[model samples]
Target: MNEKQFDKIKNGKGFIAALDQSGGSTPKALAAYGVQEDAYANEDEMFNLVHDMRTRIITSPAFDSKYILGAILFEQTMDREIEGMYTADYLAEKKEIVPFLKVDKGLAEEANGVQLMKPITNLDELLKRANERHIFGTKMRSVIKEPNEEGIRAIVDQQFEVGKQIIAAGLIPIIEPEVDINSSGKKECEQLLKKEILKHLDQLQDTENVMLKLTIPTEANVYKELIDHPRVVRVVALSGGYSTVIANEKLKENEGLIASFSRALSQDLNANQTDEEFNDTLEKAVQSIYEASI
Candidate 1:
């Protein structure tokens, strides 16, 4: 590991504060939009879009100033070996940017009052892949499913095991526990989510060099509560489902320090927006945060 580089990441509160205001929304959303059932038909177009989006982001003021922007890679999007190679190459070229690998296959569905567990059972394969990613000059992050106490415990155990493997291989691990809000009211959900997060972090003590990627609660106070946790070292807010613009605005409002935005920029790319337009919007957004902090 580059101690100097790692130190830069560890000491970057202002940079993270800027990133919290903008980064993750573009990649996750774009992956969701581009990798639909028939998306493979337009592989070239999708790859180009990803390439353009990456370039635009890295050139933004945030990247230049050393903000830690994280991105997650979904299996659906990189199912092919060549696709995975491309992603690794792209990420390796931009080693300063944090690139996360999404391991949970998908959301577990509730059936007849019973929630199913969506575990990435192939631990060796996942770790092997993450190791390959490290060789290419970037670290990895994974997402754990939100389930009942038993399920959550299982998820935490699995993640700790994975974290150990990641550290042995010299990679950073991000433990992302996604809070489900579909069935519960927003305020109630946020409170419960906070409790769950605290519980998970406590269990994660044995894991070294770990960060938390949490979903921003719908309630403002709930967001504040989670952000205020003394044990919380780093917080990367999710862009949530489909609403990238709204997500970006909300992240900024909540003082979230990092974002993995994908959807909003994908829309702009699909609409054939010019590079200038995309760059201008990102610059303005980042500038707003920078100026506000000053």
Candidate 2:
């Protein structure tokens, strides 16, 4: 691990930018940025357009390390170049922001009330490339839709299993087991998730630290223990479909959890905006999220 990068993520005051929208989520992200579906004819064109959007955001003056600690990038974006350098290098060397790669293929079909991560057939190869490209760590996700203890346990187990692999490969893993915000048993689900996560975290060795990206708890500071765990590097909150205002409001209620927002961060931005307007919008989002995080 890059010790400087590790220290930054461990103690940074700002939030991570989730620019890792992939496959199905890309179109929705583009539409929110004012790019219509008709603008791209094929998958390649679609990826190119989204990459351009990411490039704009990454290069914006408002997207600086003073208010942004790190960024989570899609696999396609990781392989691409920006400002004549690999994207990860640009983030770490030029912008002073740590870079993490999204490593999961996506989720499996919901079973036992949860959607576990699909198998990552090429994770080793991906990790090799990530290290070569100066990536600091990786993020993978699974989802829980109910308070089924069995399902939540399975999700945490799988996350830890893969997270161990990431650790062995010399990268910190951001384990994300997201609970659906609209679940009828949302609070119960959060409780079950907390219990399961604690069980796994207790089993880790002293050297095996991992990050967590969780849904904002239904109650304030419910994850304070996770935030303070010796085996936890940092605990961040996902926007989970909430608007920026709502997400930040809930985030402030939790003293330690910071933001790793995708939709909420970009909600106010538009592809049609001038550079100055875009920067101003991004600056507001960055500053607000930074304040809530700190």
lDDT of each: 0.47, 0.95
Instruction: Name the top lDDT candidate.
Output: 2
Give residue 12's error in model 1 in angstroms: 1.9
TM-score for each prediction? 0.63, 0.99
Task: Tell me the spans in candidate 2 whose CA falls farther than 4 Å from its real position.
Answer: none
Lowest lDDT 10-mer window, candidate 2? 128-137
Candidate 1, 219: how far from true, in Å? 3.2
- Per-residue lDDT for 1-294 in model 2, tens only? 899999999998899999999898999999999999999999999999999999999999999999899999999999999989999999989899999999999999999899999999999999999988888999999999989999999999999999999999999999999999999999999999999999999999998999999999999989999999999999999999999999999999998899999999999999999999999999999999899889
Counting clashing residue pairs in each candidate, in order, gives 15, 0
Q: List the residue pairs that clash in candidate 2.
A: none
